[model samples]
Target: MTKNIEHQFSMLVREIRKEFVGNGPKEISTRFVGSWAVSEMKGNLTNIEKFMMGSKEGEKMVHEARTGLVKKIYSDLSVRRKFEDLAGAAILRIFSDIDIEADIAMTIFVFDRPLISKEK
Candidate 1:
């Protein structure tokens, strides 16, 4: 990636963290590859769902929240404008897949083709 692309990608991650990290222990990282931007996050859970991953009800709620997050990212004009140029293409789709292991919540952000530049 060029310097500009790297900067745009970094900004995307920052936006995501700012929107989602809300008073929680969270770790975030991102990468751009083949017209895609991928992000991963591990965050602390609230007491209401402290062992959320281990149960069906908790998992359902988490999945629902992830969908809402994906929607917010797509709908936010600031985020869209920041990425549109760097991508040089419109985003095809955005979604999150999640998992839990050893009491940790992990989320993976998948931006389908056109999320980033394919010029490389």
Candidate 2:
């Protein structure tokens, strides 16, 4: 299972590098824990629309893209094959809200078992 997870993570890194960098350099890190996948990336997005990402509209665009990235990851074949449920996720904060150059982290719930709630 560890090997499989590593392989899946590698595939994800490949996708990220291909889609964002296009044979360029980008810092990326990923981890898999108990059906949860986390990815931290920096220098992923080059520019915002046409202007710099520090602009007001650029921040909005990044926020919107963060939402869309969830759907995009879930749609991936590797991600889809790992876990069956993607309804209620945990933390999925990709792209820095302040600057596009900042590190972005993406966390996926990817729960394979039933979620349990504690009753007080």
What total of clashing residue pairs does each candidate reach?
A: 0, 0
**Taking the tens digit of each residue's C-alpha lDDT, what string does model 2 give over 12-86?**
555744664353226555565544555555555544432545678776786667556646755666555433333
Query: Local distance difference test, per candidate?
Result: 0.56, 0.49
Residue ranges of candidate 1 with Cα displaced over 4 Å: 1-8, 20-25, 44-54, 86-89, 100-120
Model 1: per-residue lDDT, tens digit, 1-120? Answer: 455665556556556546664533366555666666665556644455555656887778866675566577667777766666566666665655555343343333344454444465
Q: Give the winner by TM-score.
A: 1
Kindly give the stretch of ten consecutive residues in candidate 1 with the minimal lDDT sum: 100-109
Per-residue lDDT value at 31 in model 1: 64
Task: State which candidate has the highest lDDT.
Answer: 1
TM-score of each: 0.58, 0.52
Residue 18, model 1: lDDT of 64
lDDT of 2 at 27: 59
